[model samples]
Target: MKRHLLLTAICIITITLLNGQAQAQNLRAFMQNSGFLSLQTDTPYAETYLSVPGNSIVYKTGANGKYEGALEVTLLYLKDSNTVAAFDKYILRSPEIDDTSNITFNMLDIRRVSLPDGVYNVQMQVLDINSTDKEPLTLSQGLNMHFHRDSIDFSNIELIDSYAPTTTKNVFSKNGYDIKPYVFNYYPTSVNKISFYNEIYNLSKMVGDEDVIINYSVKHVQKDAVASNLFRFSKQKAAAVNIVFSEFDITDLPSGNYLLHIDVRNRKNVQLGEQNVFFQRSNKNSVGELSNISLLDVNHTFVTEIDPDSMVYFVKSLSPTAEMYEREYISTILQKNDPKLMQQFFYNFWQKRNPTEPEKEWAYYKRMVSYAAYNYKTAIDYGFETDRGRVYLQYGPPNHIDGSDREPGAYPYEIWQYYKLSNNQSNIHFVFCNADLVTNDYALIHSDALGELNDPRWRFKIYNTFKDGNGYRNFDIDYFRSTWGSQVDQYYGK
Candidate 1:
């Protein structure tokens, strides 16, 4: 039997996930949930590994079957909150589209950096080198590292996508280790094997002349059956410094979620240290056993006590999601007229989001929804019905908002500046102008956010108005960009 801990895949989300990342740059940063890897070899320091999301870069076709895209990644190892210690910049370009359609480049851009032992606030920026107007995508992470001089220790487990016996040396291979990193924790059906590498230091201090017992296993999530908990493999480490690099064929493991578990024990079989990372295996060859393991859905055992109509309204008030899958779900449920079932679905949705406290989560969001309704209500619509209200509810309030109502011949307009939006974009502005001119219904006319209105001529639309004996007329202007303001403070009101 293997001594192990039952890791609820749910608990892994307690800490700040990709949501804790910095705001978006030109490229929407797509990082694996656990993309950082720190490993120490032959020194008292470690090299950090991070995988930047690929495929998000705008790819264009070039002549003769080539795909053109350029990315510049800058890593700043901050000494403190405001001080920078070291930096690394990598410029990557793919001149050819080896596989254009496999756009989900899960393990696309890999970055490795060497630094001395200390905690660092890692500020990373990914920029589309092709565009001069696009903002550089930026994200920050805290990098904490410690190396003991006289104690047994292990480096973070590094996942390798594939490996082969090497006869020569290259950037991807070191000391005969020809390996490609498995950036994300996802292993599709095409990925046949899983390999990992890690370094152990000063192990002789713990075991003396005896060997260090290493247990390597992959356990199914939350399953306590004997087969799911049995031992996978165990090895003896007979050296002070060990580079444990090996691969295992996972073709037979049924398609499901698993943890590649590693445990280091002393000679007495007492667990000394352990570390593991989450991974999802998609083994299509497996029988129908894993069919039910669809997208992670909580047990549909809970129900909402709210009335059906109120529940529908609550769902409607929820932005982004309400406009997306949540809306479709409610529409389908209107046919069944089963409030209990609807409640279950609603309960499960939030439960999946904040499993520890779904009620608290709902309460907080409900408060925001109520606030939105109160502030954005108009003659024919509720607060949540307005465009500004939807954006406020969906992306939350802007960091700083500026407005101008008395500009000559200009519509009452406002610019909402968000310092950051959900690990996506930062310094983004939403320009809302009073399109109706009746009540306070300022509509979103243009924005610089990806997929949002990016009209360079927004200035003309906002200011190209003249009161010609009637209301106003659509017209033009001269050097509005220059007369408006400087580049940094681009707000219209002087």
Candidate 2:
């Protein structure tokens, strides 16, 4: 009986030691080093960490305060839309590390994986055996890593033809001031030697001099910075003149998005033209891989990309809905009973919204949609819900604007001014004056007031006239007669 009791005690002590060893080997904290950050292991037990770029790592613990015997790690490289799902799965299996008492377990080795040259994020998880301890710790990290390839001369890349250059209007306003007119277009990349041509005779109407200053900036998506180069062009003659731009080689740039801006100004340094454009260069394969390159479709009116084949395909995917209007019809759509026509509707919908190149317009269009969804989403949300958002998306920004809560004579009013008018400029003023006024007695209404109201049909008021031995008769209307809705009209329109 004595020998049996001693043996049992020894066995129980050995089992307890084994359990403690397992508990100490559990995961502590997951560290993701993006080639910029560093991770070190300090746990009592040896650990192994496995990783794949763009995927999260999960660590689970058991009820005994540790993982089972050996932990296995699976690495998955996500493709395209699988990002979110992968992240969620990782989070579902993560383990909770109790740092309250400062009792830390072993840390796994840090694993580094190469990622494509683009924006990406990595998540970490600790999977505890207890279902209750499965809380994942997620962190967002980015890698602006450049995937370089052997420099191949792109001199052979040629522009067979270019998109027909178009022009449109944009307005820039500060306080109550209006800037001059300006035109914008996508910088055509098909041709080796690019040039911009313009005539400036009509510009004299806004500024005393015929000369205008042009400023430009290039947005490089991968770099997250604007190009330092700025160019200036002076308009001197009524005759059409062309200026050639510096040669560009996209061979070194990563496959991603880009944008360019063109601002036209007069001698006064006032901004005449400020236009934003979006462009994208895509390689079906990785950045280092020699792959087929394509340009995304843009929908802006004046902006056009050189790839017409893609443009035609992009235009053929619009679906006609009950929301269609006469003005929304496209020349590309004539099929009354085409089954594949749904795609064509997609094309037309975007084509109509194109302010420049299809791709350029598409970016802004999506951004506008996003802005609307963020700012104006309601139980009944519409794309054109807010007046400010509508004007912002459709016409960019206004040149001149005035706003007041009071009516002109009784309430408030706002006025907008535009110094330059063209396809690019539309100046507007918003007036808010109460049309109703009860006088003590008789009052000569100003004739200008009658015309100002624009319709003898509507009720009128008197301005600068005397009533009850007092001179005060100024008539006004509170309705919106000008285009783009009056400032007060915006209140009612909303």
Candidate 3:
């Protein structure tokens, strides 16, 4: 069975403004939760983190005559039969502001809940208390927490924004440190380092006071291999509870999806236990060193065997899996129109992924590209250039697809569900729609996957519900509530 450890949930909220009429306003917020085990107490607990931008909410005069925004946050953990296992409901208030227009800070909240070892469905709801909207934003996902008492296990990795020696015992304090949770798994250009906290339990039972090696590294999601420069290891004595509070300098890390792995190895160099968390980096300045490509020897290599024209097409097909910097480099190589340069770059790309089997890697990817092209080609674009094709090439095939072409009051839409993504994400979904209807090409409008398009007003586009004067799509809550013959919500939720 797979474990559901770190989960990042995104919710879209509809706030109703009251001025004798209800106006729909949209707000987006992020929520993340992780489960951990307390060996000392023999208990399991969960930590929930929420981040809501202050400017996205409405502020009203408070009891102290100051403008403030408040959100009523609720969390519910349900069992297999839909029975509530644990729940929490509370009001999270933002800092008092002198002017609502200047509200630019994010309101962060943390909650800790104790739960036993079991699988659960977690539901979260958030509502702006100041808004007249009666309905709140809600989202649900799965959660699992299981740690055997006699076997070595790792707690879910918690990404940290900042940490210092604990001055007071608070909800954020853990293992003598006051750790601020980095709610999002996304790290933009401004974030230069990645810090995390994790715990290993029952090590003493397995190793019996023997010294073990703790190795942690950042691995590229596509290559499934550790980055050469980002690996580290340390020696420690096995104990009942071992803690790892460390960080890696990601200043030079390129923009791509990656996994941070924590592994425990026994004294005899045997594997014991491992845990990994997914994250995305966006460092636009750290482009691939294209100048180094000239130094690579492509003579007699696999790329030399391909015709010049075919090599260009093959290089273009790499867009789905190429990093931001690599894509930029590929464009340069294509513009240069140098066969040797393109072959060198192409061979190097596959070589990085599979040092000993670059040809095998390219052969397999060539097959996938051909398949995607054959199935998803559009009128003017190749299958790889289309949205659905791009997604298929990038993430492989979906586990299930719910496609509807004749739904009432809605465009042809399809919801593709992936039971699990290669990056360790579970139950991910992608929403695609064909508005023109004539073309079979389905454009991706929304997705719950990290680093993909996430449009809160996706339903509006699919249903053709409402648009403002400027022809911009706007979500109409009233229409959604009264509309008939639309099962998109049901299909998407499933």
Candidate 4:
């Protein structure tokens, strides 16, 4: 029986997979800007999301003369490069792609798969399931699988999307745990809290009747000896494949590499077992400490514009420019109750960027602020406070936008397209949804924006399945496949 590897981790990378070399190197389909989520294998059941490029698969005109593709995917948990254990599956797809300019333009076909635990070199091959005249396309890559076969072990740490007690047995529910997994490792400033899942095992073997104190801490790992504590908590629980699910507020922690450090100990405080799972944070508010850098005002000419109410809107307006100043620095400045310094710093901020015409620059941005307020503001929230408003202020107007209204049975959503939001990203699209059914306060649900919310399962979010506690609809995957006329693949143009 196949266990669904349904752990969703958002990972983004640029690919021009028009050739065999590009096709041979990767199997990921819609990963955005995060690392692949790791899954532990020792459990009786496990699941994850995997993908293959549609173009990589060989296709042909059927007996009916319609183009079709078939793929066979297999994973061999490796003992070295040699296979130790294996799982395999076959898939047939009808890609109704009209863009014939590039034969590989149908886009990647993502699928779910299951496997037994071992280190794996994932291998995949594709063929036209109907026509057998052409050679099949093949690719392979190594993956680390710590299927926690240890006597005293833990499951792979799962970043939680959401979880409630199981009321229904579905894709998101397992072993009395109804949990959804996030698609990315990098958490930005907007993500204030982090929730995750891990399972403890063989505690009955390590200890007898007495309960043990289990501790878990999120430590910001540094190159130096000092690793600051971001969050710490402990609990007492019995031994077994014990489910350990916890959430921590990482909003205050500086952006960097961090590890969730876990330790199991006895009543004497002696450690029984320990493990760590590493994750990266890209919160601009948490990026780096920039409190000391002074913008030397050769001419403090604009000092007259400084005042107490500047706190009311100046930094609030400059929230889009979070890359320059740390959140703590700004918060610290605001808390100090010093109006003059804040104004001086604010004036220097505009002057440094546009020395000759600082007023012109500030005025133009303020117009964007006003525009955001007019378009995205709610009864209580300013435009800049809303997701669409913040995105408007930060990235300016999108060059193109698609899907202005809700689908027949889907949530109200808009797809904003940017020609080039950053040096590394081109033609990125963000999917914003009015999940609350509000008119002007659409939240940024998912995007391919380089450093934005790059949820891989956007279709799930767009369809509101996540609200009902399911990762997807009954046949949403099949629905997405049937609807891609020609416009869908345009979002991923090279």
TM-score of each: 0.48, 0.22, 0.74, 0.42
Comparing candidate 1 with candidate 4, which one achieves the higher TM-score?
Answer: 1
lDDT head-to-head 1 vs 2, winner? 1
Q: Which candidate is the best by TM-score?
A: 3
Better of 3 and 4 by lDDT: 3
Candidate 1 whole-model C-alpha lDDT, 0 to 1: 0.57
Residue-level lDDT for 42 in candidate 4: 31
Worst 10 residues of 3 by lDDT: 470-479
Off by over 4 Å in 2: 1-342, 348-357, 372-390, 406-426, 430-494
Per-residue C-alpha lDDT of model 4 across residues 1-494, encoded as one tens digit per residue: 00112223322223343422222222333221111213354333334434445554444445564555555543333333344444555564647443323554433333334444444444444444433334444433333444444356665566775678899787667568776666456677788878877767777767766778777777633221223455455656665556667888877666655666667888888877765555667666643324433544525465465456754576667766543233345676677766655665666667756889887888888889889888888887878888888888777888876764645556777778887743323566777877777566788876644335544445555665343444243211211331423233344343
RMSD of each: 14.8, 32.6, 7.4, 20.2
Off by over 4 Å in 4: 1-300, 465-494
| lDDT agreement with native, every candidate | 0.57, 0.30, 0.78, 0.55
Query: For model 3, how many clashes?
Result: 0
Cα lDDT for residue 447, candidate 2? 11
The deviation in Å at residue 6 for candidate 1 is 21
Better of 1 and 2 by TM-score: 1
Q: Which lDDT value does model 2 have at 281? A: 42
Please identify model 1 stretches exceeding 4 Å from their true place: 1-55, 58-67, 79-82, 96-112, 189-192, 220-231, 248-257, 281-494
Model 3 off-target regions past 4 Å?
Answer: 5-25, 63-65, 132-134, 291-312, 328-344, 351-364, 376-381, 385-494
